[model samples]
Target: MGNFVRIPAGPDQSFDAWIEEPPADRFPGPRPALVVLPEIYNVNEWARGVARRYADAGFVALVPDLFWRLEPGQYLPYTPEAQQKGRDLYARLDVAASTRDIGSALAWLRARADSNGKVGVVGFCLGGQLAFLSGVDATPDAVVSYYGTDLHKFLDRVPQLRAPALLHFGETDTRVPASIAGEIERHKLPEQDLVTVVHPAAPHGFSRTGYEPFHAEADARAFEQTLSLFARTL
Candidate 1:
């Protein structure tokens, strides 16, 4: 259902992205495209699964390796040691450059013959934060962030968002608590009404299926809302 493709990031730099396309017989024409941002663990199996899910839903999904600059093809597991390694790599990530890479991905998708010229972005964990940044800096048609850590730091940029945005947070998430989520909701600028959902008792990484701290109910609800958002906006 998917394969790796190279995308030009900047001059003399390129990165691999896992691309999945919906069945042509079922989708039957140019379809909306999606840029699926992976967590700090990079384009691991779970992240690729996300692209597959979006493809099955009739969208062309592409998952870029956000950590390519630091480690070209690193795919860490969900173990404690791997978690620490992911965090370390995440700390060294340059947000501005990664946002540029996302823009390149969007451009690639839009240039594709199968695209309908509509593109959206959905991200998890660290990717979630990048999604929010993309809303502020890039031109994705829509944005969705799941439990994005340090979102409060960028609350000031909410007013600059040109695309409709949906953010999901876990009520009990230590990285992004309910108070922070409330702050984001309250910081709306004029018509920039961002939809935020805080799942009750859900912990960080709630939407990550087959992983610890995954809340099935929250995952289902957030995914439904995400699909609805893309349907209406993209």
Candidate 2:
């Protein structure tokens, strides 16, 4: 319960992160680990609950707030005001810096008390892209992406992702068209460690709990399969 911890980033003009750990009481043994990266909204209750769900299933999960770099204490996509603020902040974000911050989270967890050194990563929306990109450098054993946008376009630069990866997509999601997904599949490495699913009748963010776009059946199925994927490869 007291697992919600904040770790400051580099002292020299760097960002800080708000992270949540799974309930220690749920995990009495050394467990495989994962870093739960939040969507553009940062670490909201949905993301925290999802992290706890993973922890409850015998893995240690940590969620890092990626937006803290541009605005401390700022999380988004809840209030219209917060959403606008997050968009404005994004205009000023240094993507390379945000990527570095993701690396920092991985490094922190690798040596932390709760970690078992075996690591995986999972994320939603923008965070999903980070999860995929991090596989190139974040020291994860596997990665799960929930409708990561623009990822197929970056396959050349992101060609080095070595970990097993799973991607979930909504059939109705225009943000990431089926064509792009096809391109991604075509470019996958020889390991062939990629699985992408298009859930029928689901749209973007269908898995976002408590959101209007949430599709109960699709979310349930997606989550069930996603957990299965992570459980196997994490």
Candidate 3:
């Protein structure tokens, strides 16, 4: 039970966010919120499905269009052409600007009448990288990252991470090899509660429902771990 919401990102700029909220009677009071960052494919049907699933599980979830600056409401389908366009948009993305946009979403969630004021974040692929960045910068209460590509590129920022994080990576995925993932596991920030796991025999997009590399077992287990993290932290 959700709908599209307009979120103000910056001066004269706004983005569309797919917002999902559980039935009010499902719980006695306001519920926790989650900001779901989409992959390079933008906030398509699959991304919206993730928000719906979170809402179904008793959370208020929202997925913002990270590419809003480039194109206000872009939703590219899963196709070769769209992949190129998505990559182009990704290459042109200003991490700092987009992170600010995410910060706006977080503020919006906290101010909602039905929110408990606790917010967590989960992201996949490129969004996964943003989840880590957001944890370090936006300061979400909890962060879950599923196979964030090129995550190692941001290890320098880990020391500043202000929240607990749970990360999953596919063991055989070359995009983020074992060596890089291992480095992340070894690096530690004084009080940062970070957990990293490697999904045995899984690939890059293992958690994606209808993607070519989707791994059902791995996806289910990863999702369970995410839920557990949120339950305990948020």
- Per-candidate TM-scores read 0.97, 0.88, 0.96
- By TM-score rank, best first, the candidates go 1, 3, 2
Q: What digit string (tens of lDDT, one per residue) describes model 3 on residues 47-162?
A: 99899889888889999998988876778889999999999999999998888888999999998887888999999998999998999879688999888878778888777777
> What's the lDDT for candidate 2?
0.74
- Model 1 Cα lDDT, one tens digit per residue, 85-136: 8999999999999999999999999999988999999999999999999998
lDDT for each residue of candidate 2 in 102-138, tens digit (9 for 90 to 100): 7777777777775667778888877888888887766
List the global CA lDDT of all models. Answer: 0.90, 0.74, 0.87
Give me candidate 2's TM-score against the actual structure.
0.88
Question: TM-score winner among the candidates?
Answer: 1
Please identify model 3 stretches exceeding 4 Å from their true place. Answer: none
Which clashing pairs does model 1 show? none
The candidate scoring highest on lDDT is: 1
lDDT of 3: 0.87
Compute the lDDT for candidate 1.
0.90
- Model 2: residues >4 Å from true position, as ranges? 11-18, 23-26
lDDT of 3 at 123: 95
